[model samples]
Target: TVKPPVETVEVSPPETPLIPPEKERAPSEKVTPPLEVEERKEVEKQKEEEIEVEVSREEKEEEGKGELKRRPEEALERKAPERRFSIKTIFSPLTTITESIRKRKRRTTALEEVGPPLVKPKRVPRTLKEELPPADWRVLKEYEVRGGVAMIRIYLDPETSNYIYWVIEPPLSDVEKDNLKRLKDLLQVSLPYSLEAVEEERREKFLLEHLDKVMEDYRIKMSENSLEKVRYYIVRDFLGFNKIDPIMHDPHVEDISCDGPGIPIYLYHRDYGSIKTNVAFPTDEELDGFVVSLAQKCRKTISVANPILDATLPNGSRLNATYGREVTTRGSSFTIRKFREEPLTVVDLVENNTMSADMAAHFWLAVQYGESMIFAGGTASGKTSTMNAISIFIPPSSKIISIEDTREVNLPHENWIAGITRGGAEAERPGDIGMYDLLRAALRQRPEYVIVGEVRGKETMTMFQAMATGHTTYSTMHADSVKSIVYRLENPPIGIPRVLIQALNLVAIHKQLKVKEKRVRRITELVEIIDIEPTTLEIVTNQVFRWNPRTDTFVYGGHSNLYEKIMDMEDLSRDEVLEERDRRAEIISWMVKNGVRKFWDVARVVGEYYEDPHRTLSIIEKNPEVEGNPLEVFERAAEKGRKEHLKAKSVAA
Candidate 1:
């Protein structure tokens, strides 16, 4: 509050009327009385009243000496006798100036005890909220990423409406930046010329040697509050994804891209859709330098001759970048398809309308029984993510191996071996580990399930052969339709003789579509391969499930050739297999309802269910957060089995 400026009574000083100048003055001017007789009498009366009030105050002070000794507060509340003569002089506003000063100090201390001023104060950093706030910046949400939590925000630009942004908290300090530069120089000095060409995996080993000392030196230079920031930025810039690392960690960001220098970084946001960001590469030279650094991190290099680069980040994000203006007029550019650290589970897909619960339940049944499936989709159609999510349906104890050009498949199974194809000068050499090489090696490993990240070339044949050998295969191919999938398989480079192609049982066509103006990827069609004509090599297919674009719903043909194949393989009656599927579906529904979305949590539930179904059901059934019957799977199954038993008994009678 603006304090009233030292409250004081208005006092009129006695005015002096000017006499006429000597030249103009008449003899009568000297004789005239100054200020009139009435004014003089009034002034005299005011003086007398003031004198009387002072005398009264003196008398009261003498009488209250005993009270003042007992209670100091009482003196502040005391009223003086000068109500009419309330003019305040510096000497005596009310008795001693010292007493007045004490009272003012006490009131000021009380005002401060409550809170700061009501008006917007200067920016100040607090433990939680910031002291200083710019007019525009507003944080929309905060979420944890790999190394640190990130803040996602939106703000109106002068021209544009709003732009989405991702920034990590505990921002890096200047000293840390200096430390990072020093560390990078030190790293280059320590490595041999040959070792410098090594891939990201090996570079990590090289950097690890001096990381402790580097961190200690950085830590010593930073303030106590800045220690965490130092660590975060160090990991983020050097060990993590660098400038893009903040957005890469955001689970909501599906894609992170920088078009070129002077262009803002754009992120495809899960909630708000695509939005331009504040992050930008300031110049071509600077961007090229960063891209070169990114290449080295990926264990690759970019130059005028090798201007294009494609690689995977340590976190599994796909990086497609270009160096210099040789490729195009625009400066260096990069697009990163950020991979979620915790790959989505079946619950995530069902909730997202990418596929229905019934579809997931079917996948669960088929996958568990070792039925091979091929997920085909256009680019950015969520082929790999769906493949990863459904892989959770595989029994936890099963040994699984995943092969890819980039390591994208995330499995919960402990016995899983993830493989990525090698690149650079040694790629075609005998020591090279390509996708086909990895697949051949994986077969020897005798894995129960083999996952191929993507098949675009010669590796496609090996993947199908792996499936033909009774290895339950999970792989993705870039094909929009089942017919297209066959063509790609039978065509050159991927040349699987049409006969060997029939080994692939199911073809799930996943695609992105606009529903109600919003983009969503759904299983547009699911086809079961029944036969390949012996004479004509004509592929026969059973269209089991398809998405109805008009209704934005999945059409599941309840009967599947694959499921029938499952019946023959598992040696179980149809009802028993169906019951198992329903039970798994129920477990998934329970988890989705209870907010168990994390991959680890979903994996735990599936593993626990495998160990003890009833115990898992009981755990869910007892959870108060789960509404209705969490044990519906068991209850309904028991009822169905009991009815079947009664029918059998009646037949015997």
Candidate 2:
């Protein structure tokens, strides 16, 4: 360590430097370069000489031509080059840009060299005259106009020329004819013009000849299988081979029901709803064959053993047929119910005067309040139609179970379960699952409402039991009045006791009346079940409302005992009850004003009001004008009068 210290060396600090600005340069130093100065002077001299030459030339030319003289500087300045262009030249740049873009796109889309290119086989060209055989062809039919095209139907025998069979020719122009010939040549087909084609008068003769040939050929084929007469009838009548009836094109004939072979056919027309058709079969065999044809169209079969067949036609109309005397007492009978494009609605019923607006409203309230009801009517009395219309009154949020023997109920509700019963087959022992089975199952679902399409068996007992056990139910029965309904229910298969019958809140009797020569369904009576009389095993009828056929109006006879019992249970005073009734009527009137003419529409509104009576009452009070009708003033005054009357009665109490 001591030796290293002796060899130590010293280092000096770095020296500082300074820079000078151009303003501090020496007085003798030059700042400009000689070459640059000389170049500027030469450029100025050249510009001046060029200006003087131009001025002299301009002055001489101006003096010679007697035009205005220009200044030396202005004369020397060159004018901008003038641009002149043709249309093509103006678009030349754009065209080039477009071509370049197209070329680039083409290059990008070109296939890559993945493999060798495919070569297609070359097609050979052949002349029509060489391939076709010599045969006498005839024009079957021809329709033409002077300046317009003509349509020609031609028939050719395949044995004579297999390449050319039938031809539908339209008159062609010179250019089109040439094109057609070229087409015929390319296809190696014949373009022979028959004598009848040129002769318009002879076309009909040829047509008849071809028709006879076709008919003879068809008869031969059909006769081999014993179907000649059947085929003839089909071609002559149904298919309209010669002439078709205009009525066949009508859509409203839902069904064509025929009881016997020689009987007239009854058509279920859509407008003028049902009528008897003029057509009839001469014999049972003919009718049986027709029914088989109808069944075949429905993709079903009919036989001697299974003579009775129920099937849906291609057009969705339901067809029922009975072959021979097996199913029918007389002969082969058939019925067809045409599918409705638009099903009947409550509004439709109201508009058709099927029921009064108040009756519809009452049904709405009844359905909304969960009152069990039965629509009693005879056949064609619109029992199912009335049920369908009433079903729309079910609350949208409720769970509904509907049992039907057929698919008839068309409800708009979302939370609904629809069940249809199956009929027993002839082969094996019939299943026990009938309407009663479905009705019983429906009760297990804990439904808010149960609907039976139509009661005809023991199912009525179960339905009545369900009604008695706190389930709101609706059903239709084949009867014309309350007494008939009770008699039917208390009798055979549906044997429900009179006590159980009292569970029903209302019986709406629908009757089919011939009003103005038109069949109309009318709710003749709406009877309430008051109680079961001890004297007779029959239910007491409290007629709440009745329809006057003479006046075409519905009349309220007296207070419904059911409603009075409900009022009494609620402990409401007489005045309060009257006020509530008036309120209900006002709500119904409000509904009518708002275009609520259907039972279902009324039911929905009433159901909503039932859920929150106070809110509905307040709405009515606040908006005296609902849907632009000021009924609130009258309602408010009536409400005030009722309140005052209630106070006076309370003081008396």
> Root-mean-square deviation of each candidate, in angstroms?
21.5, 34.2
Off by over 4 Å in 2: 1-255, 260-263, 268-274, 279-301, 310-319, 424-432, 565-653
- CA lDDT, every prediction? 0.67, 0.57
lDDT of 2: 0.57
- lDDT tens string, model 2, 1-653? 11111122221211221113544435443333222334334435444221111212211333332112344333222211121111222123555434433332211011112222244332224423123323565533333321222121223444643222121212234543333222222112111243224355664444334434433432322232223323332223333211112233344345567787666556654435554443556566677777777767656678897897765554445568889888787788887665554556566676677776666666766776778998888876777778778777677799998887545666767889988665521113366357777888888899999988778776777888899998999888888888788788889876877888888998888887766666667888888887877987667787877878787777877576655655667887756755666676666555545555544444555555756566566656665555533434434544665577689989999
Q: How many clashes (backbone N, Cα, C below 3 Å) per candidate?
A: 3, 2
Best by TM-score: 1
- Using Cα atoms with residue i matched to residue i, what is each candidate's TM-score against the true structure? 0.64, 0.52
Q: Let me know the TM-score candidate 1 reaches against the reference structure.
A: 0.64
How far does residue 3 in candidate 2 sit from its true spot (Å)? 99
